[model samples]
Each structure stands twice: as C-alpha cells, then as structure tokens.
Target: MKDGKRFPVVEENYRFECTLCGNCCTGDQRVWLNPADLMRMALFLGYGHTSELFRQNVVLLDEGENGAWRPRILFKSYKKLRFCPFLENHLDDRGRITGLCRLHPKYKPLICRLAPLGRVWDAETGSEQWLFVKPAPDCPGVNSSRLNSLRETLQQYGSEIEEETAFLKKLQHFLEMKSEPEAYQELFYFIVKRKGEGDKR
Candidate 1:
C-alpha cells in the first residue's frame, strides 16, 4: 500500500548508532552549509550573526547555475589535498580529539547528519535515490541490536535529507548534460575566477 510514484521501496534494514568515530569527517567531500545550519551554529557559538563566522570558517564553493554561492568548510593541508579543519586524528588526555570541533554535536554539517546514506540521482528519469554505506567491517556500531524504523529515521532528519537529494539531483542532471569533466571544471573555475577578479578591483 505504498505510493510508487513518490515513494519507491528502498532497502531499510541497516541501522546505525554513531560511535563518533569521525571517519567521514576527515575527507575532501563537499560539505554544504545551509542557512538554518549556519544560524544554529552561530547561536551555539554565541555569535550575534553568522555571516562573519561563516566567512571566516568556510569557503565558497563554485556558484551554481543560478549564480548562488554555495559554502563549504575550509581546511589547510601540508600537501595539496583538502580536509576539514575541525577534524583531528589524535585523542587528548581526556581521550577526546584535541583541537577538534568542540561543537560537533551542534554544528555538524547537514550531510554529516545523513551519514551512511549516500544520495544519488537517476539522470535519465531525474529521480532521487538513496543507498546505505556499509560501515567498515571492523566498526562496532554495525553489530548493534537497536534499529530505527524507516519513518522514525526519516522524520528525525528529513529536511536535510531532502536538501541533499535535491542537490544531488541537480548535480547529476548537470553531469549528464555536460560533455566532459574538464568542461565542468572550466565552468567552475570561470565562475570562481571571475569572483576573485571582482574582489581585487
């Protein structure tokens, strides 16, 4: 009795309880920050407005086709690779990651909230889909007996999930229409370069 048009039967067996292992936080994947996230994070950090905090802590990704700026967390690296500045690999005396995000519980990115659920879009039909990311074979959370019902899981984080789905759909559509990776790269570079040039003058 499920609606096939909007709700396809997706596998919902996997359940997760975050051990705060921080594996996913240490990558170069795009970390999108929406307005709501920014506001909440700023408030949690006692900032009157998030604009300055966002600008200081985040970098703008390439502008979308609609010319809106997309923001992502920025990091400095010894090499050319990017990472999250808030991620730490070592534990402190108290056994917590030192110099890492103290506000992780409140300021995690929307994508971080939807971890283990990779969103993809079908280019031909423009439909969104979700797939589970099986944890590393050694992860302890994988063996937990607690399970979250599909409705409960969806309700807990639906807005962010929907936003991610929409973003993936748009990205997939663009990729399907684009001729080559270089073409998309050039487009992104052109947009970013133009903005930089404008700032210099």
Candidate 2:
C-alpha cells in the first residue's frame, strides 16, 4: 500500500498503450532513480561514474530515511513547461508534435518504463504490489484499442523490475544499519563503488 491506499494490479478490463502525448513526461511528477537506474543511465551516457551523472544531469534529493540521498532526474523547461530531460518532440505521421523518450528502447528510468503501470514495495511483507496508474485524466493511452494483456506487458520488463527492486531492498537495509546521514550520503554522492553491497551491476 502507498499513500494509505492499496493499488490493485491492472485488470483485463483495463487497456493501455502510450499515445506519446507526452503528458506523463511533464507536470510535477518525479522520475526517481534508484541505484540501478543511476548505474545504467551513467553507462548509457558514457559516464565514468554515477557521481559524474549526478553532477551533470541528476539531482540527489534529501527525502530518504535520515536524509539519505535519493536520486531524481533533472527537468528541463521548454516553452514555459517542465519536462524530463530526456523528453524529445517530433512530428508524427499526421504532422502533430508528439513526445518521444530519448532513453527509450533501452536505458529509460524504471519509472518511465512502467508507463501506465505502477508498483509499491511493502517492506513489512518484502513484496511488491502492482497497480494501474495511467489512463490518467490527461493521458489518452488508455483509449488505445491495440493493447496487450497486463501480464504480458509487465513480463516484457520483468527482469529489470526485479533487479531494481532488489537494489531498493538493499538500500533500505543499508539505511537501517547506518545511523549517520553522511555515511549513506557518500554512498550516492561521491563513491562510484557499492561498498560491500556487491558488484556495481
């Protein structure tokens, strides 16, 4: 459960496919980057270290336990609107301007890859609860008639989702063991290595 409510997994009654309207890429939504996200994005961008990516494009928020660093993608302002830095616009076949993700095909942040789906971690149970978060009032993706089963859609990125979740669990464990904010902060800000957390994959 998140925000005091349990989100049910997507059901057969629901249908969704991104229309590329770019609505989900904008507004006040936050594109949180987990450790895996930081690592992959840095590698994709040819950065030598996750800290370098943080220095250039990502912002570490002081929103985690004991103010442990939480990484988030930086937004770019265009035409008085704020959007993900990776958001790009192009003319569709009908000449309408539509949005595209620059990191797509590979390297999109897990949150962006989830699209119409969402998941919440229940630490007490150490399990994930999946749910629908799209067909958002402003998004037309849910109206698409050509849609895949929720199971299939999710399976397409199952491995990646699991890997990120594992890393998150590790992070939570670290926070619980470390009492000093600075101790955890360096793990994200300056260190390119994962300490004793295993390979940097």
Candidate 3:
C-alpha cells in the first residue's frame, strides 16, 4: 500500500481495540521485531541477554553472513491456527477469539500495539503518516467504539514510538548508501528482515 493512503476514522478518531481475536497476530504475516522489541521481551522473560530467547524458540534468528543477525518472533500454531508465539488465549474466550498478548503492556512488538492503525515512514517528506490498512478478513475489533482512545494508547508507547521511529530513520539512511559494507552488520541488524516460521498459516 502507498504511504498516506486515506482511511476512514470513526467519529473523527480511530476506533480499534484489539479484541485479542488473534487474527492480526495470525495468518501468513510474520511479526517483525527490532532490537528494542528483543530487549523488552528478553528483560520481561528474565533473560540476561536477547540471544537466550533464540535458543528457547521464543524468538527466531535471521543470521545474515558473519555474526550479523536480527531477531523475529517466530509464529506458532494451535491445531491449524497460526499466530505470534507470544499471543495467548487469555483476556477473552469467545468464538475464535483468544486472550491477549503474553508480552503485552510493554514487551509487545510495536506492530501489535499499533494494530488497525497502519503507519508508513516517508523519508522524502521526513514524516510518518498513520493509516488504516484494508481490514483483515473479518475483524470486529477494528470498528469497535472501544477504539476511541487513540491519543492515550499512543501516549502509553511514546518512548517506544520514538525508539521505533529513530531506528527506522537510521535504517533508511543506511539503505540509501551506495554500499553499506562498512556498516553491513549493524545495518542488517537494524532492518526488520522477515523469516517464515512455516508455509502454512
């Protein structure tokens, strides 16, 4: 999708409360992670280092040549349903809906925290625009009135958004370089590389 694509915001505000339906967390999409996400999850899980999650299958390693590697939250499945490894059926138990994110509140990936709302960073404009991607197959939470607290929800993750935006800015700069061999490892680590946990959902 193009950046700044217009989306219908309800009553002049975005309306979306993740019902923990797990639809956003599932499907063929992978939950890409950044160093900030890894550090949060690691600390939350009581791991001294981020690498520890790699060994436990909590996070998957995408090692580019050398020691250059990035971490991703590998997808896991229950029966035939696929989702982020950290998503669990907790908060609610209705229909196909599950509970909540295991790493929520703080360690949740930025992507998950900003569900329903999509964002694209425009380097040319030097700004990031929030958007609403086409809704998932049929997610009820997207239009739920409970999604009224856009500012408050975002406020809770102010530091995280800053960290994410800063990380993206750096990555964008490195990607623009003719060749990033000198900073190849660091650049690769900063980029959110995708690694499929499986072929099926």
Candidate 4:
C-alpha cells in the first residue's frame, strides 16, 4: 500500500462544508458529553438550568477506568445503534435521509458541534491535537474547494475552548478529592450538582 498516512491530528487541515446530511450522527460511535455540554443541553431543552432531569433521562456516566480517561458522561445512543437520539431525520417524497440534527447550533452537544473535526488530548503534556476528517465517506463537505481556518472555524462553531479549560480544572480538583470507594458515587452526584449550579443562577 502507498504511504497515505496523512498528517498528525494537530497538523491536519482540510476544507469542509457540512451539508447536514446526518450521516455522521448515525453510526455506532461514542458521543462523549462533558459538564458544559450537559448543562447547555439541559438549559436548551428547558430543563431549568439544572441537569438533574437530563441526567436522569438522557445521559450515562462511564466510570470504567479502562480507557485513557476516566469517568465520562455521555449521551445515550439511540436504541442499539450509534444513532444520536436527538438526530431528526428529514425526508423527501419517498422518505430518504436528507438532513439531521434538529438541534443544530443551540442545543447540540460539544462533540456534535465539533463534527467532521477530530481531537486528541495529551494528559501528560496538557495539550491537544486537531484533525480534519471526513464526516462520512460520501460527505460532500470534505470535497468542497472552500478553505477555512481551523481556529476560525472552531470559533464559528461557538467553540467551548474556554469552558473546556475550566472543566478540566474542575476535573483536576475532583481527581484531587480522590474520594474513597464508598463515597465515589456521591462524588459523582456532587460534581453533577455543582456543575449545574452555575446555570441555575
């Protein structure tokens, strides 16, 4: 095979113009939700600024320590497939995939908001690598000639860089708390409650 390794996530840059075909939102992929995402989505869905309702009904917390990161809060993939529950399929006369993600910019999760672009985090160095990937094999966004700045494009998406940084700081503090096993569950609830408190105000 030819050496088509492409570039590192950080150096990756490509043109993309999302057609909102919903292909990316449909599949067995992980949609990780951070505190910010939870809070924003709750508020968007009129959950009264607190994620309690949303958490109870919409999200799942992955506490397994088997991966690079520990204690992840994520959206419940629709049914058994990776289809996002929030994805709304638009159809034409005969009914076919036309558009998706009904809650696009406003209530979209952080991951969904950053679709077609990929990111990798370095825990040790506290750095992130960026990659511009095709949202799907048939995604027309990747083939467009229009070019966009990664930084600028992120800004256009209403990037949560600042909030993500703050969340990491909170995560650090939570890690430092290092609760005993008996209290770990409580700690999770506490974090959730605390994270949503700000939006309550």
- Give me the candidate number with maximum TM-score: 2
- Can you give the lDDT of residue 156 in candidate 3? 72
lDDT of 2: 0.70
lDDT of each: 0.54, 0.70, 0.63, 0.58
* RMSD for each of the candidates: 9.2, 4.8, 9.0, 5.3
- Give one clash count per candidate, in the order shown: 0, 0, 4, 1
The sequence of per-residue lDDT tens digits that candidate 4 reaches over residues 104-179 is 6776777666766766555457777676656666777777787667777567654486667655555555556664
TM-score of 4: 0.67
lDDT of 3 by residue, 26-142 (tens): 776656677788777776887665566777888775543223344568788779877777767653434454757778776677876777666666667867666765346678786
Report clash pairs, candidate 2: none
Q: Which scores higher on lDDT, 1 or 3?
A: 3
By lDDT, rank the candidates, best first. Answer: 2, 3, 4, 1
Candidate with the greatest lDDT versus the true structure: 2
Ranking by TM-score: 2, 3, 4, 1
Clash pairs (backbone) in predicted model 4:
9-130
- TM-scores across all candidates? 0.54, 0.79, 0.69, 0.67
